[model samples]
Target: MSLLKEAFERFAPDYLERYGQSMLPSHRRCLTDISSCQTDALDGSLHVCQSCGHEHYTFHSCGNRSCIKCHHLRTDKWLDKQQDNILPTRHFHYIVTLPSELRPIMCSNQKKSYKILMTSAFDALQKLASDPKHLGGKIGAIAVLHTWSRAMIDHPHVHMMIPAGAYNKDDDTWIRGREKFLVPIDALKSIFRAIFMKRMRKALPKQIFPQAIWKKKWSIHINTFDSKVENLLNYLGRYVYRIAITENRVLAVSQTTVTINHNGEALHLRGEEFIRRYLQHVLPKGFHKVRYFGIMHSAHKQTRNRIKLLLMNEVIIPDRPVKKKSTRCLKCSSTLILSISVLAPRNFNCQASVHPP
Candidate 1:
C-alpha cells in the first residue's frame, strides 16, 4: 500500500470527526476514496490463468482524481491523445499566477474563482496575440490550472502552451512570432492582471477583497520551448490528474505526524495538519484543470488539420489505434481469463482455482 493511503487510513477518521461538518463534500469524498482505494472495501475482479489455472484476485481502483495511486495510465493516455493536436511550429510556455492577497477568496469560492482564472488568462493571451505588433493573427493555446506549490501550498497558477505563430482567417496566411519571444512580458502581465481583476470583481459582487491586490504586479513567466512538443506536454500532464502530493514524496507516517521530502529536505507536520493541507487542493467537483482555446479548441479541428497540412506539406493521417493489453497471471506468466465468479463472496480464497476443468 502507498504511504499516502496508509497515512490517510490512519488519520482520516480522526480528521473527519473533527472537521467533517465544515468540509466540502468533494474534500470528504476524496478522503474516503483515497483511504479505501484498492482495498476490499471496493469491488475486485477475479482472473484465472487459462494454462495453469492460477487464480488472481485484484481490487478495483477508486478512480478518484485526487488519489495518487490512480491516474498513471490516464496521464499517459491524455498525452498520447494530445500528440495528434500538437503543431510543428515552435511553442511558448506561459505561467500566470494569482496574487497571494486573493488566495483566501479563491479558496472560499473555488469553482467560480478557478474558472475566472483560466478564462481570464486565455483572454489576455488572445488579446495580445491578435495585435498587429505581435503575431497579428489568432493563436492556439493549451491552458492548465495548477493550484499548489511544490510543498503543497495553495499557489494557484495557469500554465499555457501556445504555438509561436498565428492563423489569419481573413487572407488565410500564417504569421510567425519572433524566434525567441512571443509577446512582451510586461504587456502580457498588464493584460492578464487587468482581465483577472475585472472578472474577479464581477464574480464576487458582494465580497470585499484587498484593494492593494488590484495594484499588485501579478507574476507572469514566459519561456520559449524549441524541444519536442511531447516533452512540454509531459510536464503539464503531471499536474492534470494528481492533487497536491504524491506517494513518493511521502517519507514517513506515524500516529501523530506525517513526513514528506521536499527538495531533499524533510518536512514534518501533524497528521491533521497534513490532511488539511492536502484537502485544500482537492478542487471542486467536475472542474476541468486543462482547457484548449483558439485554434487548438475542439471546434477548430478542421482549421488545425489545414494548418498541419500547410506546415507538413502532406495529407494528415488518422492516429493508429492503441491496442489494449490483456491481463496475465502473476505466477504462471499465462494470459488470464475473466471469471464469472467475480461476484464471489469477499472471503473467497484466491488459493482455490475457479478455472474450468
Candidate 2:
C-alpha cells in the first residue's frame, strides 16, 4: 500500500470525526476521496487479455486533482499544451506574496481572496509594462496560485512567468527589457498593495485591511532566467499541477507522526497536523489555479498569432503524443482489456456490482 494511503487509512477517521463538521464541504469531500482512492472502496473493472486470456481487476482512481497518484497524467497533458504556447524570448519569473497579516482573511475566504491575488498581480504587471517609461507595450503572462510554505504552513502566493519584452503599438516593433530587471519591484509592490486593499474592502471586513499593511511595503520578487527555454519549461511544469505535497516526498508515517522532505530537509509533523495542513491547500471546487492574462489570454487570438509569427525563430516546441499507461496481465505480460465494469455505487454504504452489457 502507498504510504499516504496507509496513513489515511490509519488516522483519517479520528481526524474527520473530530473536525469534519467545521470544515468546508470541499475539504470534507477531498478527504473522503483521498481516503478511498484506488482501493476496494471504489469500483473496479475486470479485464481479460485478448491474446492470452489473462484476467485482472483494475480499480478506478478518485480523479481528484489533489490526489498525487491521479494528477501525473493530467499534469503531463497540461505541460504539453503549455509547452506549445511558450515564446522564444527570455522569460522572467515573478512572485507576488500577500502580507502575513492578511493570511487569516485569505484562509477564511479562499476563493475571493485568491481571485483578488491573481487579478492584482496581473493588473500590476500589465499596467507597469504598458507605461511609456517602461517597455511601453503589451506582454504575455501565466499566473499560478500556490498556498503552502516549504514547512507546509499556509503561505499564499502567485507565481507568474512573463516574456521579457512587449509589443509596441506606435513603432509596430518589439521592445526588449533590461536583462537585469523587468519592472521596478517597489512599483509593483505599491500597485499590488493598492489594488488588493481596494478590492478586499468591498467584500471583507474593514478591520481585515489594516493600516500597518498599507504602511509597510508588500513582498514581491522578480527573477530573470538566463537559461535555455527547455530549463524554464521544466521548472514551470513543477508548479502547473502540483499538490501541497506528493507521495514521493513522504518519508515515514507512524501512528502519531508523519515525516516528510521539504526543500532538502526532513520535517516531522503530527499525523493529524499533517492531514490538516494538506487539506488547507485542497482549493475550492471549480477554482482555476492557472490563468492567462494580457496577450496570452485566450480571447486575444489576433495578438497571440502575431506574437507567434514574431517569435517563430526562438523555439518551436512540438506537442508530442503522450502514451497512455495502463495495467498488464501478470501471467503473460500482455496488455489487459476490460471485460467487466462495476457500476459506481449510488450510495457510499453499498458495494458496486459488475454490470456487463
Candidate 3:
C-alpha cells in the first residue's frame, strides 16, 4: 500500500462519519465516487493490478471539494482559467473582513446575507470610484468569498482582485493608478458599513440583527496594499483548495482534542464537541466559494475581451480534449468499449470485438 493510502484508510472513514453530514451536495457526490472506486478488502488487504500484476493495493480519494485530500486537477483547471484572465497591468488583492459580531446573521441567512455582502461591497467600490475626487472611473474588480479562518471559524469576507487602472468616463480613457492603489480607508469603511446597514434594514429578518451589533456597528478591515500581486495571487490559488484541516496539516486527532497545525505552529485544542461546527462552514452544494464580479461577470466578459485587446498582451489558452479513437484490445484487434474513465486515481477500461466484418 502507498503511504498516502494508509493514511487515507485510517482517517477517511472516521472523517466522513464524523463530518459528512455537513458536506455540500457536490462534495457528497464525490463521496459516492470514492466509495464506488473502493475495492473489496480481503483481510485488510486490497486487489492487485491485473495487467501488470502489481500491488498490495491502491486506495482512491474522495476528491470532495471540502475534503482537501486531492486537489491536483481541481487546482490545475482553476489555474488554467485564471492564467489568461490576468491583466498585464499591476493587480492588487484587497481583503475585506467583516466583523465576527455579524456571524449569526450571516451564517443563518447565508445565501441572502452573502448576496447582500456582495452588493454592499461592490456598491462601496463603485460609489467611491465614481467620485471625481477619487479615481473617477468605472473600476473593474473580481470579488471572491472566503467564509472560514484556519480552524473553521465562521468568518465571512471578500477578496477582491482589481486591475491597476479603471475607465475614466470623462476623458474616454483608462485612468491608470500607481502601484500603491489603495482606496481611502476611512471612506471605504464608512461606505461599506452604510451599504450593509441599508441592505439589512430593508431585507433581513428582525431577529438576524441583534440589538448589540445594530447599536455598536460591526468593524470592517481593509488590508494594506499587497506590494507584489504575485504573492497574493499565489496565496489565492492555495486558499481555493483549503479545507478546515487536512491530515497533512493535522498533528493528531484524539478523543477530546483536535490537534491542528496553523501559522507554522502545532497546537491541541478542543471544546466544540460536534463536528458540525467545522462542517457548517463547508460551502453549499455547487456553491462557488470563489467568485468574480465587475468586468469578470459573464455578461461583461466581452468587455474583458476588449480590455485584453487594448492591453495587446494576449495569451493563448490551453486546449481541451476532443472525442477520439480508442486503444485496441490486446488479445484481438477490435475497438474497445470505455466502461469507465475517471479523472483521478486513474481508472479506464476498454474492450474490443474478436473480429470486425
Best by lDDT: 1
Candidate 3 C-alpha lDDT tens digits along 1-357: 232233334444665776578766644554444344333321122333344433333334445665544565566567656655755556666777776778877887787777788768877877887776777777766676778777667888888877766666456566665556546667887888888878877886575455565455444544333335545565577667754544466666555565667778876555233244445666666566676766656666666666666666522333433324343344343443233322322342212221120
Q: Put down candidate 2 lDDT per residue, 104-165, tens digits, no spaces.
A: 88988999989999988989888899897988999878888999997789999998888888
**Using alpha carbons, what is the TM-score of model 3?**
0.69
Ranking by TM-score: 1, 2, 3
Clashing pairs in 2: none
- By TM-score, the better pick of 1 and 3 is 1
| Pairs in clash, predicted candidate 3 | 336-351, 337-351
- For model 1, residues 156-215, the per-residue Cα lDDT tens digits are 988999887889888787787897767777888898888887898898999898988867
Task: Count backbone clashes in candidate 1.
Answer: 0
Estimated TM-score per prediction?
0.90, 0.88, 0.69
Model 1 regions more than 4 Å off:
313-326, 339-341, 348-357
Clashing pairs in 1: none
Off by over 4 Å in 3: 1-63, 169-172, 211-228, 246-248, 254-256, 270-274, 309-357
Per-residue lDDT of 313 in model 2: 75
Candidate 3 lDDT for residue 90 = 63
Error of 3 at 321 (Å): 20
lDDT score of model 1? 0.81
Q: Model 1 misses residue 201 by how many Å? A: 1.2
**lDDT of each model, Cα atoms only?**
0.81, 0.77, 0.59
Candidate 2 weakest ten by summed lDDT: 348-357
For all candidates, the clash counts are 0, 0, 2
